[model samples]
Target: MSNQHFLTLQDIAPQDLDALIDRAITLKAAHRAGEASPQFPGSVMAMIFAKSSTRTRVSFEAGMAQMGGHAMFLSPGDTQLGRGEPIEDSARVISSMVDIVMIRTFGHDIVERFAANSSVPVINALTDDFHPCQLLADMQTYREHRGSIRGKTVCWLGDGNNMCHSYINAARQFDFKLHIACPEGFEPRADLLENNSDRVRVFHEAQSAVEGCSLLVTDVWASMGQEEEQARRAAAMAPFQLNATLLAAAEPDALYMHCLPAHRGEEISAELMDSPATIIWDEAENRLHAQKALIEYLLKTA
Candidate 1:
């Protein structure tokens, strides 16, 4: 099988993207049924994390274990790459040992440069510009709750951070419309917002963007490495919170999703977040199944 890199949603064709989500749902059911579904027995995945995380680390490591594979945890302090060694050299050396690699880092270029030199499949666990892995779990959760997201409308609330960026790419890959409601200075990448203008729309008001939408999603007001700006961001994004009022305007069965580590009463309201109707927990758990399917897809094809 040829080496494939999952750096972004565009890396996979639309049909294959849908296939992966369906496979993830199947894997979840099979696991719950206690059926044998080992696809990567004894495989090794090198997880390189330059940034800190709770969901990303736990989900990937747990997913590898469930698939009969080993996952190595590497921090900046644990490897030479953290000490200023070039990523190209590290990528060449690490790829030779591991069957697959996962990187959660600060910049998008780091993953791009590493994949260019690696001989094995590389997955972008998370990057400042895109969190494609989270999107995988999110899309899988949406598929499990609703049906296909094709032609449906999804609304995103909060800062135009990595999650927002991934949603933009998902709009194109999943054949859906995305309405992003963010403050003026917090909008997503210019090229992305412009390149997919027909599929994506940017709004400043949450109510205006979410009305009649089928799904609503949000993330923290201040992501990691941006703690100092939390106060200011809270003030600017206060008016865009996802509360019951916004939900009332959305479709009756519209589901709410958050990529875990949510800050209640900030980007989203506590009342809605704690409500039994929220699918955030399912979205979080899908990270394990979706990533297992992803690892299987990459290694089986490799």
Candidate 2:
């Protein structure tokens, strides 16, 4: 344990990152066994959200309460930053009042600013560029089902959004092989792609991406703030949809995943999501346990 902040998956080293995933799995088992965790008894956490979220909000709040801690949800409208106050001042002020800060926002720079100015640990719940928390849950789910993620092929379909970026970050730490399928212009940013080592490969065809994949993942065609381009995105991503035919291209035992709030027919087919191979629900539930492990680790270690 150390004074650390989790702003992205890449921030966590290989062994430490694996430990967090293992801790998350253990916490989830404890919860299912009706055991209680008072790891943060009497502590308080702050969640600053500039973007609206369903999973991120619920999971972190419930996780804090479950660990005998309280969580406060602060929207942009509730903070002085909305009134033009500097983020540095807000971060310094909030850090003194809470044990840790969790932020979900539009800009990666905003989270970086909060981390830079804050005394306590800061986590990136989500950003336009990365969703590290979501990838934690996804990685935990992968390990639980497959025993290990090292060397496993996880194919990503649809737009190269935040989840894809975080997955690539995680891939760098672990041995998981990543193949991302996107339309010509919809591929992940070239700068991020260049940072990857030998574990990742990009593909223009969905079939090629899923060829030998152990897991198949997809996200909504349009993420928040991208709704204006939904029609164009949908048309360009039509061929990347996760359906029965596409799933057949992967390994026989390949599992399926979606960082939910899925757009039924857009990024995935209903039949595929309803199938037994889909671990979407389990992955969603793991978000709570994963965040609990993360919060407890940050508060105790930091």
Candidate 3:
């Protein structure tokens, strides 16, 4: 095993990714059966958040406790990094004191620099450029409900933000076809799309992208830091909302997912979010199991 950093879905090999998902499933079952493993007894995970969170913070903190490890939360106000400390300096200091580090921040380069200087494994909890951890949970939930995502067509029907970029990575790593539908200015990073052109396609109409797709997904119309643009985004993205009509165009058994903290009636309608086709709750819960598996993999591998 070699030291590694999970900055993106592309960080791990296809086989390892598959194995991690399987491990997450097994761990989830064990958890339900009241069998907790002390895989990282006495270890510590330092969680640094420049960006605020609910799922990322809770899931990682709770997962660590369940695994017999402790997780320390460091907010921007509490850490010098927020007060102008270089990312490399902060990474060196924090990683030395913890067994693993998880960072949820703005720039992708922040995590990159931290990982470059860290002594322990680094996990990208989230970033403006990619949210790989969420992708793990999404994949696990899909596998649990459907099956292998390979060869399946997945439609992303909202802001081409971090989640969208991670989905593009997922499509390539998991061997699936990704149909991304976002408003013109909201399209995912051009370099990312070009890198996985064979596996991903972009569209301006949600209906067209969802057609024949086995999985349909979306995110909030305006993500964090884009709050002021909510009204404008809502108008621009109105045509791309995931509603009953749009969902109807997808495969009959198609599953709908949202990374959540969802804005009902914005990116997706409330009725549609509550529909039987939606597996968002399961996707949310998988975050715990998937991340536990990830922590175990990183620690053990390291």
Candidate 4:
């Protein structure tokens, strides 16, 4: 794990990613039964958060405690990283003191640069370019509900943002196909689309994109740092909302998922969000278990 990082879904071997999903399911069951594991006692993980978070912070901190380790939270205000210190310098200092590091930040390049200079494994908790950790929980949730996602069609109906980018990578790593329904200017990184052409498709029509898909996912149309553009995005992305109509376009039993903090009635309808049939709650809970397996894997392998 020293040389390895979890900045992207591609960072973890495809086979290993599957294993991590299964392991996360196992860990979830164990946690519910009051099992305590001391697999990584005394381990110290540094949590660097440039962006605000609820799930990322709580899951990582709680997961570390459950695994007999400690997590130190470092927001921009609390660290030298915020005071204009070079990323490489901060990485060298923090990695030297910690067993591992996880960062949720603005730019994907921030984590890449930090990982390049750090000695310990650096995990991208979240980034403007990808949200791989959430995809881990997502994969686990899908695995629990319908078994392997390989060969399945997943409809992503929203901005081709970080979550969509992760799904693009997930389509490759997990051997699935993805349909991205985004507005003209909201498409994901062009290189990702070009690189994964065989497994990915883009469309402006949600109905057309979701046709015959097994799973449908979306996120807030305007993510953090885009508050000023919310109204504009809302207008442009109106057609892509995950309502019953769009859901009906997919397979009858298709699962609808939103990587929470959903804008109900915007990217997704409130009825669908609260529907018992959907597994969004399970998806959210799996964040802790999936991250625990990730931490265990990195520390044990290193």
Candidate 5:
């Protein structure tokens, strides 16, 4: 619990990341067996959303309820921060009454500033720069199906947005090789790629990146704030779409994953999404188990 905020996966040690995945597995099994321990009775978690979400919101709220805790959802319209209150002021005020806080926002710096001023732990549900929580569920799902990700090759196909950036961090933390394939102008942050060059590589061709990969992942071409660029991105990213033919380029046993709210025929073909290799449904479900372990870890209650 020394770390007050989970703004990015880079903030966590490699060993801790491994432990969290293991804890998530244990918690998941316990939950299914009706043996879960309610470790946060009377606790409260504040969920602040500057960006709307389905998975992030449902997972956190449901996880809190399952743990015997309460979750309060606050949007820009519901909070004074929408009216120009400083994020620091809102953080201090909200954290004072809550046991934990999870923020899904635009800028990465907003959560950093909030965590710096808060008394309780802060979780980065998502940001334009990183989506560590989703990575947790992804890694858990991978391990449950294929064991340790260490020494494995993962292919990321599509936009170099939050999910891609988080996968870069996951490669470093999980000790795996990551090959990222995206359109030229849509590459991930240069600093992030440079920092983890030892484990990450970028490619313009999705086929080249997926060759021999054990996991193939993708996200929408245009993210929440990039709706205006839809047509332009579609043109640039059309060649990189994940389909049966493109997936065949990967290893025969490679698993397919996507952070949900996927565009059926944009990032992936409709048939590919329902293909046997796709484990996206499990990946989505793991969000609840993974976040529960995170909450337990942050609260020192595990």
Candidate 6:
């Protein structure tokens, strides 16, 4: 939590990272039990989003507000950075005014620069390469329903995007067996594959990926700005859909997960998302709790 940056999962030590996760779980339970307080009184968080979002925006804003902190939204076109101000300058300026800075942007380097120059804690809301916050909520969800993440099997059935990258990173720190099922061209990055190959088990087949798995996860087949290829992506990812047949291949109690704003019949079936085993609402609710813990962890260090 020290040294002033949250550039990537690699920035956090494994043990400390686990401690944060444990804290998140505890915080989530406390909040649900109506025992948690708005600990961030009079604090402020600034959100710089070069990319658009619905859940990320609402979750962070509402989470901070619930913790007695206010969030200021700054979109790319609405800010001076869009007019050619150096990112470092914007980072330094924002750090001076806020208790914490959250950024959802295009490249990883943009977030890295912000964290590097900022004095306050830098939180990655999302980026082209990693989605640490989302993963935090995800880990909390697993802990809630599944008891423990260690020694469990997590099956990812979609493109190896930022979410998949963070999941693989988490797998390395925790003891979960990860099974990634992506189409040939849609596989996770090679370097990520190599780094976590020893820690996780990868699969090209959805059946093999979900077999005996404790959890099944997926994301949008086509992410934002990739709308041009929606048809192509849908075609490529159709066979991997989370329908009843595929869900049956996993553990009988296997839970379903998706980073929200799911395409109803595209990536997951409506029935599965509304099923008894679905914990997505819990997952969605935990986004607030997980971020509250993350903010507390970083602010405590300060």
Lowest lDDT 10-mer window, candidate 3?
1-10
List the candidates' TM-scores in order. 0.98, 0.97, 0.98, 0.98, 0.97, 0.95
Task: Report the Cα lDDT for candidate 4.
Answer: 0.92
Model 2 per-residue lDDT tens digits across residues 1-302: 23488999878788987899999999999999999998788888899989898999999999999999899999879879799889999998999899989999998999898899998999999999999999889989988988888888889898988888888887888778899999999888788788885788899989988999989998998999999999999999999999889889899988889999998877999897787657899999999989888887788778
lDDT of 4 by residue, 110-212 (tens): 9999999999999999999999999999999999999999999999988999999999999999999999999999999999999999999999888899999
Give model 6's TM-score versus the native structure. 0.95
Pairing residues by index, what is the TM-score of model 3? 0.98
Positional deviation of residue 163's Cα in model 3 after best superposition, in angstroms: 0.5
Instruction: State model 1's lDDT.
Output: 0.92
Q: Whole-model Cα lDDT per candidate?
A: 0.92, 0.89, 0.92, 0.92, 0.91, 0.85
lDDT of 1 by residue, 1-302 (tens): 24799999989998998999999999999999998775679899999999988988998998898888899999999899979999999999999999999999999999999999899999999988999999999999988888988999999998999999999999999999999999989999999999999999999988889987999998999998999999999999998888899888999999888897888878888998899888899999999999998999999887
- Indicate the residue-level lDDT of 132 in model 2: 92
Q: Which residue pairs show collisions in model 5?
A: none
Count of backbone clashes for each model? 1, 0, 0, 0, 0, 0
Instruction: Give the CA lDDT, 0 to 100, for residue 161 in model 1.
Output: 91
Tens-digit per-residue lDDT, 1-302, candidate 6: 24456666666787877788888888777777888478889999998888888888898898888788899999879989999999999988888999999999988999888787888999888888899888888888888777778888888888889999988988887778899988889988889888788767667678877898888899999887789999999998888888788889999988889988898899999888778867888888888878888888888887
Error of 3 at 211 (Å): 0.8
lDDT of 3 by residue, 25-143 (tens): 99999999999788789999999998989999999999999999999999989889879998889988888899999999999999999999999999999999999999999999999
Off by over 4 Å in 4: none
Q: In model 3, which regions exceed 4 Å deviation?
A: none
